[model samples]
Target: MSETRVHRADVKTAHQDLHSERGALRGEHPGRSRNPLIKVVDLAWLEFEKPDLDRAEVFARDFGFQIAARTDRELWLRGTFAGSPCMVIRRGRTSRFIGPAFHAPERADLDRLARATGTCVRDTDVPGGGAAVDLLDPSGFPVRVVDCDRALSALPEQRPLLLNSGTDHRRTNATQRPPREPSRIQRLGHVVLETRLFARALDWYLDTLGMIVSDFLFLDGRRDRGPTMAFIRCDRGSVPADHHTLAMHLGPGTGYVHSAYQVTDLDSIAAGGEYLAERGYRRSWGIGRHIQGSQLFDYWRDPDRLMLEHFADGDLFSCDVEPGWAPMSTSGLAQWGPPATRDFLGAGPSPQRIRDVIEALRGDNEMDLTRLLGLLKAANS
Candidate 1:
């Protein structure tokens, strides 16, 4: 497939509307800012510390992330999002902050960012090869921005891995073989985070990045019928998108929350969920339509226990769209579900994963990811 690229389009200075002046550049968002023109990209990742390494691995594989490599302490998983690892299961319970990943145009962007932010920045070379830079944000999570070049190997099986053939007779062929995939992220949509300092977080994101609020949620904080959650867009003047790339909600935590990955369709979501179950993973929450964003979502736990979301058919807003606010309601968050639960938002690292994390953190002798990656490279060669 031809390369998928983010094109530049004339967008209004979000700062001009939000603030009093036309601050900063009237030119393209510094091609050297190490931040892509983000037209619309998936969150790219959410690293979680899993207690049960094996379980986390099984869970992510079932949920549809291609297991890229694994070590005694970490497991890496990738999806349709180019060569980017959509999820990483690190071995500590200490990792907080849901850092959103933005794909920039080139390494020069990172250089530009170092100068713009006046922060000493560096790149994390891929374990095997290539490199990317981690951009720090006000929230403490380092928003990783990269002009990446990673390759994806096709799925080994086309049939749903976890679902039984008995459910659909036509699926009998699934056990046979897989078909070739031409490569495209298809497209990655947006992500939502629950924040304790919702207003602070929302303002920081909007001011630093050129995001416009498309809509919002306000709960009964008295007659203050103001917003509690905000959904914003990266406004691409003529971009044909109906997806909000980022959203913030009022909540207890101040860390990196859940991030979303977009697939091709509802079929991919359903099939991937079943495949995950067949591969032996605990389904987190989903196969439900969220009321707020109006996106059909599926959530699952990866081997590292981080939440992985698959979404499609979500609401979108133009860059110039103003913020719309409504009272927050549990009943209004989803169109369908058995009702939300505490564990629904906080799915504990499973029994097995918790133990694995403890040992790894305690300085246990662990297998390294490099060995496994070496084996994969040799096999492919």
Candidate 2:
């Protein structure tokens, strides 16, 4: 039996006026930790590659993320996610893991963290209800801070749909569907990453972001197994969604992997996925339901080989109870869908004859080992 790990992490955070729309839920929940005000109300992660950064700028504008700043190296974008810039596209041949944007409870919290962890904390202003600082997590991801409440999604236009006395479906063609939305974005959810430091990375995220592990992926280290993935939560007060604002795992290499944008429903996820597909972008995996976050999702590969996703209508939880963990396996990751078919996305196919290659390639100074190794590995067995 897999040992069931228990997490009673100790925390330290500045005191604050815990306000809320329906009243601060944590203010009432018993056993809720009093300190470590780890409510991540925003995200400010980096995009590894700046390939077509201009185009990404256009896409961000079309998708509803406000442009905060753009130079040759980084494209900073903002949104309703919080007060600070929500996403940044840093110049690279491809995207790499930069880190997450977790906000602080107050200015004092920033000071406290800087004092406690010795991370180089910085401050900025962008999205929320108050000021913010940058938090360098234990795992080395850059976390931006802000004191804004996660505002409600202001969907363009909504009306109650009613089916009254013998409403004819065919005759309602003109007014059949809801009003059109131009690639509307509802909220910022979690980001999944590829990393080299697995356990170290996990602890860093949990400790810094206050993310409760909804589940952790385990691997048998055998067969053509699937990569294990983790799911986390972020309680934004008004909305009971912390359905993995971020997740991480071992990397083929390291850097800002990819980010996910949330829409209102599954149809929207499909719509966005279809739009990206029509534009000739590569898809990584998905357009299916994930058992962890329980969100309807679709995945795509961006210019830098990072997998981006469009997700919607994830399950909401108010129980404040984090539960579940599973071993990583080929068949266990996806509950339903075409089997994940990426050579590099979910998991590598199998083990290799490393000893033979190590001897053959010894002192081959002319060959670029990294490039040669990747090509050889990507090829047929």
Candidate 3:
């Protein structure tokens, strides 16, 4: 008997010429600055306000984070890495994303930034003993820069499983079944945000944190409108860094989009998704490869409806790589995977979202009529 075979249409041929043309634009914007206060090392953690701490804690544990410290009013969660606390949930009457904390390259960088930004440098009382300079970005999000002095005992690390391929098998007489246990999260990778001021926010991030743009996405057929979205990375000279430590896209409102944590590999993501499913968590999107940073991704919503992502095998770029330019389109967001859903696009045709759009249109912000239409077109494309 012959085996059943299935074939799909070739998409590469359709986009081959466009890919070649865009490839030529790579490295056009290295985005290295001659003088800045300090280069941001990495994203340290995020803070959120949740109404129910107990319910939030359950979701955190199932999402593969261990509780580092807990109080009646606050909870600190940490990954397997030595970083003491990667997340903080504070009890509040209403739930919302507070902001993110970033690590500077050095202890002195904290002082430098404090003076430059005219903000006071004070000691942090959080789980990690550190001094922080807290300030708000142009988009009204709280930003914390800290120099950690707390010592952390490293946790056990989970390694990726070796796989046997069709042509060359790596395992001999060994059957593999990934455990249903929670996939260990290695560390915090990045956070994405939506802002009403695209150019201002982009400039502020670049100038203040010394970050470089890894890629830029503009509205289709509107190159002159400039890039509405950017994948920005820290300027670690000669040292390889994740393709993007922070990403921002122009939208009708300013708020947190999602945060990504690094996992072991593809197996961990799939198995972890299963664990989340068994625990009755909602999946937002993914189990696919992204085009910009090239990370295998899986997204989920926590108990408080905050979006989080587990990713692995992402691209790393040295400071020399120039930023790539591309058009923003729904179909171009992923390399291969299930088609993006409206929920994933943050475009669910809900009444609240439509009201938000109406509010933005009525106000004088970046998401003007033209920009809103452009974004709608891009999402539908």
Candidate 4:
């Protein structure tokens, strides 16, 4: 498939627009693959390695995940939703993200994928025992496609609260007091990563997993260079899916940025923020509505310094909706809330980050002088 041709007028308009519009200008890279090996159903879970399993489990509970199963070597976390676990943490020498696992709709897809990729389908020891086909993405991130035989039954529901808006008041005699407690996490929504090989990695996901672009963000005055960031979702035909199951951006570093989990509503996010703050966990950024996915998000740092997000009320879309394009800027990140924090942006200069930039510029990857300058300009914008 060829890249979608965008009009000059659309590019000019998108430069000033923060909201995504269908049929907007895109880069030279195509938004999707004409034919893919297998279309993944949804994101299953993320894998991580942490030195202190005890500390990780404590934070996981506070962050609204239930312990599905725990062992001396491993810890599995789950949400209230009826499905697989949300995350798996293994005891390791240091804390780091391992990779992500996607759910395959059928068992045969695993065999097909294994055959196509020349890899064997192996049984996984996760909570809901299943078989998985493992592969590596263009950016060298470990990716697993699993056909889970068993599914976890849904936990007790955490009902949403009735509200009294400006015009409509649903609650008359009942007072509004959301308890200060851990937000009941519903499920894993999406994960964001930064990679030096953005174009190649974007194509790999679209081609390998049958994912499609929901929105594309390009740096201002550099539309010709194509999109530097993409919010990608699964193509579930007529069924609606989350706006972004995965988001990837071009950056000096190649690793996990953050992972988001769905909560009940705005109250859950706010109250959860208070709960975490009281427990001495740092709030990274959020309590804001994002412009891309339209999710009301609140971010927090885990004991290992990994960023996790509590989000609610995100946009969903059917496969028929084409990708939208917009200019990338710090101001365009949210619809309403406090300004994006420097910590959240990774803007604060650190020795390691500086070293990554220097190495990325010197390496053979996409990071060059112009791209680096454009990223700096976008961050400041």
What TM-score does each of the candidates earn?
0.63, 0.66, 0.91, 0.94
A best-first ranking of the candidates according to their TM-score comes to 4, 3, 2, 1
Model 1 weakest 10-residue run by lDDT:
2-11
lDDT of 1: 0.53
Show model 1 residue runs off by greater than 4 Å: 1-42, 71-74, 81-83, 93-98, 127-135, 149-189, 221-226, 275-281, 302-306, 316-320, 345-381
Ranking by lDDT: 4, 3, 1, 2
Query: Judged by lDDT, which candidate is best?
Result: 4
In order, what is each prediction's RMSD in angstroms?
Answer: 14.2, 10.6, 7.6, 4.1
Candidate 2 has its poorest 10 consecutive residues by lDDT at 11-20
Clashing residue pairs in candidate 4 (N, C-alpha, C atoms within 3 angstroms):
none
The sequence of per-residue lDDT tens digits that candidate 2 reaches over residues 1-381 is: 323222111100110111101211232212123344454543544434465788777656545466667788778775454345557677677445555656555566666666656654443433334445555553456656555444323434222244334655534434445443334554566677654445556555556555555555544432123223455665455456555677775433344556787666655555556666666667777767766666676777655456666776665644244334444444444557655555334444444334323533563222235433433343222
Residue-wise C-alpha lDDT for candidate 4, range 1-381, written one tens digit per residue: 333334434543452354564455434556789999999979999999999999998999898999999999999999999999999999999999999999998999998899999999999987869999999998889999998889999997668999888989798988888999999999999999999999999999998899998889998989888899999999898798998999999999999999999999999999989999999999999789999988999999998899999999998877766677788999989999999999999998999899999999999899999999999999999
Q: Rate the local accuracy (lDDT) of all candidates.
A: 0.53, 0.52, 0.83, 0.90
Report, for all candidates in order, the number of backbone clashes: 22, 20, 1, 0
lDDT of 3 at 117: 91
Between 2 and 4, whose TM-score is larger? 4
Off by over 4 Å in 2: 1-51, 59-74, 78-85, 91-95, 119-121, 125-139, 146-182, 220-229, 235-239, 343-381
